[model samples]
Target: MNLYFPASSDKKTVFSAIEKYISDQQFIIVNKDENRPWGGFYVIDEAQAGFFIETWFKNVYDPLPRLQEMVSPKILVVAPGKRLSWQYHHRRSERWKVIGGYAGVVQSFTDDETEIKNYHEGDVIRLQKGERHRLVGLDAWGIIAEIWEHTDSNNPSNEDDIIRLQDDFGR
Candidate 1:
């Protein structure tokens, strides 16, 4: 079961409700197969800073009380003319939804070839494991909701997950 809190909802009220529901063990995340087209549902909790979803894998029978700390589901705001590094992940996959402004996503499987796509608000971009991708803000500031998940559950670490082929920020 999935619960969504609107952007206008009160933070204190939502947080208290989530805390109460969790303590009562009423909130649980059910996992379905990846073949289902979309990912499994999550018990999402929102705050002013951002939001995080608690999701479980279909192979795992027991649900974790919370998601991994390194797994961050947050809003990314990229300033105009700025771009993230051209990088790939070894153990993680990310789905990005453009919420505001415009974005240009350059992604590819190999370092030699890349494809760029323009995205407007409400557009979604999915990056699978080992896919090199980069996000660029265009025209104005771009805001995107990034749902980051670990592909390898057994080894969930960001120590070497990111392989940056090119970076403008110099690391």
Candidate 2:
């Protein structure tokens, strides 16, 4: 599955291409974030473990609060072979980077169709507009960091778009 497109600033095309690649390999993309001064790619695995690594705002001399403002901005760890439930969001995309271990990511469609793909440390991925997705860890893993819109990442008040396609928790 080797496909390429010219350098693109088009976010939709960028995402679409990445989506196609992951899909072709049967993987899921879980997050996409653009509201920041920088961008992010967040992913998760079948064991419900997440990977959203890389640090930003390092440009700032003192970046602690800057990061915490968006999120406490810390590493995410998950056990191997775990997966998260299928769900969607009304706002905020997520970005993930595999920092350690291997993963099988699962991206889902509105109608419940899904594909599985794999990623390893140093790999990056993203999710977009109401895309139902999740991840499965192929091996014990941990994500270095997760940065998202402070107001949108996990605000329960705004989580009305959570439509679980399949759930182990009966979500």
Candidate 3:
């Protein structure tokens, strides 16, 4: 299970919720400065962040046994009215599933074509590499399960891969 908290929630609130809902060994907090204004993520897969046995073996032996896809999964909690930067990645794609509350999504396949839509619980959105996208919190906290799909096996994408075109927080 993943934990979710509103963006406006203070550290105490988040910690309290985590203590009540998540076990100490379940996840590790990896908060970033840029994400402070929005919401935080409870990363379920710690191996995706740093050196791991699976990644090492894959890197050493090109095309290892058919292993499960390398994915970084997390639960995103966007505060009401807060929005993430309009960004895209070159080495990864993403699949987002709205799990709680409502959300507004903006996606663009090309420079000239853009689409905005509202999503609710159980709705899923798929974003391909180089596709510009942003998620906005609606009336309540928006909880989403995000799965980062590493497109380039040789060079997987990480937090630094974000290429922001527009941002509300001047990120």
Candidate 4:
């Protein structure tokens, strides 16, 4: 979720640079077409790999006063060998599609947590409010996250609420 002033809106050149940058690093390119064209790679640290693909993509679009926000929902790429933590979002819920990799998801229930399940490429997953969920990529695949904002903003999260009963990352 990176945005630039596009002093010239030369999408071709700028996007090319983004692709090169991402490939130069290890970030996998999830989507690169007309609908939601993205041109940058976001690398997640240990904590972030155990969290959302990018924990701070909101500001990239929010801070741009000149932009009209062509879209509300954003798509994020979670490269292979990465994982998100057991957490929930107050502002948004996400729908994930494993477009090019294996997705391992774990959900928490009232008394016990569901065993981590795997999804093949093209499988879809929906995350609702208060549904503590975590994910990780396997092999050389990645996940695309479509974010949808909730109607209410009062639902916030705290560190205490994140009860990571088990984590392969050792969190």
Task: Give the top-scoring candidate (lDDT).
Answer: 3
- Give the higher-lDDT candidate: 3 or 4: 3
Better of 2 and 3 by TM-score: 3
lDDT string for model 4 (29-91, tens) is 444552222222232222222123343233333432211211123334443455655666555
Kindly list the per-residue Cα lDDT of model 3 for residues 1-171, writing each as its tens digit: 344444555655654564344334344545422255776666655554332223222233244322366667566777778888998899998877776666889999765436669998767787899998999887667767676778888898898999988889998
**Full-model lDDT, candidate 2:** 0.46
TM-score of 3: 0.71
Winner on lDDT (2 vs 3): 3
Task: Rank the models by lDDT, top first.
Answer: 3, 1, 4, 2
What tens-digit string does per-residue lDDT give for candidate 1 at 125-146? 8788899898886655555656
TM-score of 1: 0.59
Clashes of 2: 31
Evaluated against the true structure, the overall lDDT of model 4 is 0.47
**Candidate order by decreasing TM-score:** 3, 1, 2, 4
Please provide, for model 2 over 1-171, each residue's C-alpha lDDT reduced to its tens digit, 9 standing for 90 to 100. 322222232445544554565455444445544222212233433232211222322332233323333332333433344455666666655555564455666776575656778876666666665777766644443233333333354552133655667765455
Q: TM-score for model 2?
A: 0.50
| Candidate 3: worst-modelled 10 consecutive residues by lDDT | 49-58
The candidate that wins on TM-score is 3
Off by over 4 Å in 1: 1-71
TM-score for each model: 0.59, 0.50, 0.71, 0.46
